[model samples]
Target: MIRTFFTAVLCGLLFVSCNQQQNTTSEQSATQATEANVYGASFDAENVISVTQLQDAVAATDSVSATVTAEIVESCQSKGCWMDVRLADNSTMKVTFRDYGFFLPVEDLKGKTVVFTGTAKREVISVDDQRHYAEDAGKSAEEIAAITEPREELRFVADGVKLQ
Candidate 1:
């Protein structure tokens, strides 16, 4: 009978320890960003290149695979579907998730530093698409209409993103 009671206590203790809850409240997660907050496919954030190096690499080729750290100039306000991260030369490059697989929280993420791994390429965005992005960003009618011309710009499709 003593052995049975001891075994029962041990099992209870194991259950309690195994079921320990994590502090993952939304408030904590939203406000607390670290290297642990990884979105999409996981990749090491090491050996990261600056956005300028990524730009130069793609300037001569169709695309280049790299991990880049950049500051957010703007983010998709409606759905967090895309972000315009600032480059070293003051230009912004659009970064989108690979395969539309993951999305960031819809919030004002301007000036936030983000590290991402993916393929950077140069692409010409159509006027219609540009207007769509402007609208998604909550731009005014005047701002959206001003994007009448197609833009040749640097673009990145990130497979993984680490929010910092």
Candidate 2:
């Protein structure tokens, strides 16, 4: 009888502990969501690009310049560092600052118009890292791996980006 009682107590304790853990996780997620929403505000990227193109013409007259204006389709939430922008041509391009010099909040800028100057290159977003990114974005494990679509091109890095 004592052994059965002890086993039951242990099971009860484990259940309570698990419940507490789950509650803590839920609370933390809620807090994070609130914080993210508070910091997210709409900003147009296209207007930023128009200003950047004019500045680039004067600053980089001798250098190779590619100025693009596009709408940010997606971005990393952890750091507003990089984003995927959809061009008018219906193609997406990853834009990141040169040498990781600059960053902007993704939530505030996503779906906004942005103009940037940089060199672009076709590259592959690795499957492993892509899965990791999806996980970080709070996607389920199955959802992470299910994203197998290849991103066509990435702007290697940009020297200047104007966000409107």
Each model's TM-score, in the order given?
0.78, 0.52
Clashing pairs in 2: 44-113, 44-164, 45-112, 45-113, 45-114, 46-113, 46-114, 49-115
Off by over 4 Å in 2: 1-65, 89-91, 135-138, 148-156
Q: Identify the leading candidate in terms of lDDT.
A: 1
Off by over 4 Å in 1: 1-36
Clashes of 2: 8
Candidate 1: what lDDT?
0.88
**Candidate 2's residue-wise lDDT over 1-164, tens digit each?**
99999999999999999999999999989876654422222223332343234334434443334666667777767776677777545655566666777666646466777666666554677777667666644578779868787653444366665565
The local distance difference test score of each candidate is 0.88, 0.61
**Residue 84 displacement in candidate 1 (angstroms):** 0.7
Candidate whose TM-score is highest: 1
Compute the lDDT for candidate 2. Answer: 0.61
lDDT of 1 by residue, 1-164 (tens): 99999999999998776665333465456654553578788888899999988878888899999999999999999988999999888989999999999888788889889999999988899999999999999999999988878989999999999888
